[model samples]
Target chain A: MAKKILIKKASGEKEIFSIIKLKKSMMSSGVASGVAKRVISQIRPKIKPGTTTAQIHRLAFDLLKSEDKSYAARYNLKKAIMRLGPDGFPFEKYFAALLEEQGYETKTNVIVRGKCISHEVDVIAEKYEKNIHAIIEAKFHSHGGGKTGSKDALYTYARFLDIKEAWNIKKNKGAKPREATLQSWLVTNTKVTGEVKIYCGCVGIKAIGWDYASEGDNLQELIENRGLYPITVLISLNHQQVRDLLHHNIVLCKQLINQDTLLSRLGFHGRQIQQLYQEINKLFGS
Target chain B: MAKKILIKKASGEKEIFSIIKLKKSMMSSGVASGVAKRVISQIRPKIKPGTTTAQIHRLAFDLLKSEDKSYAARYNLKKAIMRLGPDGFPFEKYFAALLEEQGYETKTNVIVRGKCISHEVDVIAEKYEKNIHAIIEAKFHSHGGGKTGSKDALYTYARFLDIKEAWNIKKNKGAKPREATLQSWLVTNTKVTGEVKIYCGCVGIKAIGWDYASEGDNLQELIENRGLYPITVLISLNHQQVRDLLHHNIVLCKQLINQDTLLSRLGFHGRQIQQLYQEINKLFGS
Candidate 1:
């Protein structure tokens, strides 16, 4: 009924401010509906043309923190996902785990054979019974300010086509199962450019970014849907602790909860552990 | 034969120190054969297994400079190529000029149409009589440290394929000449990896780095063969002067020499201008 506010994104692109998207994120953060509405009402008057999404986020975060600090931490999921990488290995491993949960046998950091040459694949995920096989390329840009675009999509597809040709040859030679359908996937922590989506679609590559919707949930939604919140999502865990936890391969809060002893090795004291458990329970458990 | 000395290249790869390569570079620098042989003999005792190419370059360069100052500038051709870029437009223009010397009608920074999207092509070179139409992709690294690899080859090929498909469609409709063969050309100021050469070969793309040979003289050899050395090759010019000269589209030393009035605009006084002309004459002519 009103003119939609244009908000500047971290990548310097303008996006329409959607109350529906905001409320969904708030609800996912465990904010009560009443509080989300109240926050939106407070934020409404401040909304003007060219107000940055970052400024809106800070305003929402401060408001959420005042209401519930733990909820505010949950709201900072996207930022925490960014903390999982500088080198991108942690993000790759975490995404591999997510695929593993979806009944795919996943391997991280694989050297896969291609038609042209050898390719260092990030994640090779296969579901034998369903005849679904995939090589997933994970691109993790730390801080999430950069947009992933067609170059990434194109190169990943280039690698995919090379490998796919080899796979087809292997299948004909009886090296691979005839029924296996090989697919290429590109996953990124950053938002996808429009060109990326178009290019990926044109090439029959399934691409997923934090905001790119291919056939299913984007990375953020997938995390929420699967309850596979990364240990980085815990605001109380500092950079060192998160690094140490990922070093032990305890990526998800779900995995860390099962291995309580691992938290001590990460320098979490008894009280801190109790608080983490409480936060984890609130975020994931009943 | 003595054990071939291992030298670390700028890309951190170990290479065999070739006397032939050194000699050829010296010959190109206008150094006499007797002097080149003497310089090599003097430098041989200093050569260690793990000596960097940078050190060897310095050794050879000092020897050449002692022999002739103007010749040293020509010997530093590769380094001059590096100075032609921070933004890369100068190198692109310089390269376009080199192509034009070969009788190719060239345009720089043209936005070309593709099937799926439009591409901002660096250089479009056409020789209608030969039915050779090309879109040249130029990659200019300010420092000659990074290695151009398969990713560049693959992505450049990808863009080429997209545009090539569109060109075919246009040709079918008689929009383009039926006999015109669309070629994709990638040129870079850095050394290309073996993988890039291999990949480009497989994809039918002509990739030429400073050293990656694709059936013709690479960028350095092409520049020398054409006598179209960049004005950056002039040691008398400072960084600001080079930038200003490039801004005015005076890319080649030959171009700059013809426009002597432009030298005064770049703050080179009468004596300095005469010296520059002498250096240019020595580098290009008898």
Candidate 2:
């Protein structure tokens, strides 16, 4: 099979540029040298057959750790609600686990659902009282920065997220009411287009172009200053546990209510029982 | 299996509220009754057993939609990210899909990771612009709302996020360039302690107790807004396609540099290619 181009332009005018120069412009020129140094270790002369992408990511994470440079993959949300097991593409989770080894307390899998609907919020982090945090959207494609065959693929994802976020807010009654806020982001080693700007606008999400050339915060700093928190309820907030809490509370309430109902069914016959019932009523209220 | 209980004794005696009162205070009063009133098709005493959680969520979404109420399950960030396919949670992706029939988008399995480090950001929407436009962090834990647990959990998340925003400003060279400029937020279903006044220190972020009971925009609306461009990017001045326009210029530079590199490698030795060499050099220089 022939190697596929990561980016392919159709009839529309297409242009290609040097990865180094592109990085220099987007990121400060000084940062490019550091990024290049880091990339040197990640890039292999040849790939070993049958290596899973997860393994490659793990290698990258490990390399960054050894160098003491921060890695983006290390910090993630808590894994309390809707926890993804090893089978899932928990690249950030795995990265976070490595950060934990460094004695950093990172939260994993924060469950941020749409308030109107139960949509997942991926991951979240916080400083002290302030909420200057970052949300990450991971993409796991077969090819690394390969050309996306579908037109407006990234845009579709962005729009979908925008709509989903809206639905979540209007639903979950017990959820904390937030404002119309979200700094939409896309984290993919995929090629995008100029049209993405308009498409993203149509919804309200941003398509962050994260390819080999792109450089973000390293894992150490991410883990050191910011804790990792995944967006899954199972992971971050422990939805199952919360559900259990709710269930436990409900069961206790039912028991109390049932006792009251039973006493009423019994027709308040005994004086002592009636006194006890009255006390229970006062405790539980009408 | 039996559930575990987490309780901590205070240094001194503290007032304990009745559990029933707590439940009533938190329960959805008018909404549930309204939903029950509209669904007169078949009044079953009990919901069916062995039904998947997703199915239950779908039913809830349907009921909410009928009442003009939103469904929280639909806005899950995880579900939206899953639309990208491999990067999302398998169970959530499918479960959210089931909710779609009821006009509710099942957003699930959103993969969010922090860019650097922070405590309070729920989701970092867009990362293209120099400054972070919005950061959202959620607080949902089973025991977090308890007497001791409630006070510290959210406060810690909030404080961490605020610090992160400040740190990001320093790292990213935000205006004023203090170790504090990145804004963030703290969103929780529960309220924070008044005594923990440290949350007041959150410079650019807001500590919000999502008080579902009160009326305001929820987390979903905030996320959707972040998806929108210009606003999401925090461009010093708004530009429709800030990234593309900037990237186009970068691409032009790359083309010029690539032309130069090619010219250097050609060696000017080939007779046939030599005639074009002078023209190429002049073109690259300019």
Candidate 3:
């Protein structure tokens, strides 16, 4: 009998390596199914008994990079997002900005009174024209193996009900009943479970996760469609550089590429600034 | 001019020592004005420039102990309460027990929904016959200098309004309007500002503090009247021992005096257990 080949997970647990799982992930990045199968087959023979999932990811990433750089960038989205935080504030800032681009006035780290208590809302977005207001809970996973599960959806739903009750009371007190509409969304940098998706849908709570959107508009699709790639996704930038960019609220790659002054303001010298610009163009422009 | 005597505060700041303030505090502890004045005069010559307020407190405490040990115990009430925590959980437990003694069914750390939001109430007490429900917020100050201020009063008022709104909504939905009456109380282990008392009184929110009381029933008065003293008041036991006792829910000194099995359960051996028993009797019996 052949010895079982295992891959070490981010959590230090080991699992049997699956070529199908690797192929599905690559396919999600818009890589052709044939290309994904070819990449996984080529990488499979190179996997050692003690090889880590990170090592396997690197192997697949390199193969995709050599074949097609844009696909490799898209494939690296989850890993790049995982690097965004030791804290969730940066992701909340990025999510707020994404909402802003969609014609909503956005606020992050807001304390709003609920019907029974006060809550520190992560991101709040409002569109006056559409009479739409959304309270968003942004969950950022700092590790590849982490997930936003069903419990998070349930908790978000409870919080939403509280906020919705406050809105209803306020409306009845002075404003028209239909003057404004309130909604709650749970946005995560990692994928959510199928159970979470089902629960959220049943409760009318919108959930946006990496590759786990209800209407084919996941976090990656939303960002890529708007050219609002986070600065953390830049190939040339290190984690520290990305963190510094996030600290200055320069979250989007487009925000950095459009402003030379902003780059200088971040204390980046001429050579480093030039490299960042070139990398941004190559990754985003193509 | 004579050099002014300074006293160190719990916040590590120094202020001019005031005899009038000392007298007022002692009077609040049930010390007669004449006795308080005599105690101050005896300690006056002993107080030196740069002497810490803690030292002055010790001098007065010794004088009170010699004159009347019960008054000394009452005077030490604030310090004993401060020893209840590095966190406020123990104080909440004690407060819940205190409410139970007052003929109210009590629940601690309860999540109750209001008309506008959900509130995690620290202590909820209900007198079934009277249909009176009181939501109590227990503010434990680990340091003597800490205070429950006007801002706390304002926040508590807002929470009260939310809970009251929920009650009204529930009453309108199905229950009779007079089925239940709701009230909110702020209970703290330190002094509250006059502003807080005034604001609370104006809004019908009950404010209870170590010395500040809305209806002449401060925390000390309530505990002393009911003979419900927290085990943290025992000078014989160290902070860790008090914390361990509180961990097992052995809050009152009276409870410790009655339970031999409970003491052994807390890992207290012969000598230490005897000392605790003796100290409890000396403090409570006098």
**Global lDDT scores for all candidate models:** 0.84, 0.34, 0.79
lDDT computed for candidate 3: 0.79
**DockQ values for all predictions?**
0.53, 0.01, 0.06
Cα displacement (angstroms), candidate 3, residue A136, comes to 5.6
TM-score of 3: 0.63
For every candidate, what share of the true interface contacts is present? 0.39, 0.00, 0.00
Q: Lowest-scoring 10 consecutive residues by lDDT in candidate 3 chain A?
A: A150-159
TM-score of each: 0.88, 0.22, 0.63
- For model 2, the stretches where C-alpha displacement exceeds 4 angstroms are A1-88, A94-117, A125-135, A148-180, A201-204, A212-286, B1-286
Residue-level lDDT tens digits of model 3 in B1-286: 5467887877688898888899988887667788999999998888776788888888988898788666676677777777787799889999888878889899899887755456678999889888878999888888877778755665566566667787887788887647777888999998887767766776687888986689768888898887788776666677777777787787887778757787788778888788777776766654
Q: Tens digits of per-residue lDDT for model 3 on A1-286?
A: 4467987987689998887788988997778898998898899889888899999889989998888766677778777777777788888998898889989999999998776556679999889888878899898888787778755765676567767888898888887647778988989998898767776776677889987776558998888777677777666677677777777888877788667787778778899888777777766655
TM-score (0 to 1) of chain B for each candidate: 0.89, 0.29, 0.82
Q: Write the per-residue lDDT of candidate 1 for residues A1-286, one digit (tens) a residue.
A: 9888888888799999999888888887678899999888888889898998888888888898787666777788888888888889999999998888889899999998777767889999999999888999898898757889888887898788888888989888988678788999999998998988887877788989997778898998788877888888786678888888899888888887755677776678999898888778877645
Residue-level lDDT tens digits of model 2 in A20-90: 43334313312235754564445343235343433444454355435432222221111121133323245
DockQ of 1: 0.53
Q: Considering TM-score, where higher is better, how would the candidates rank from best to worst?
A: 1, 3, 2
**Candidate of highest DockQ:** 1
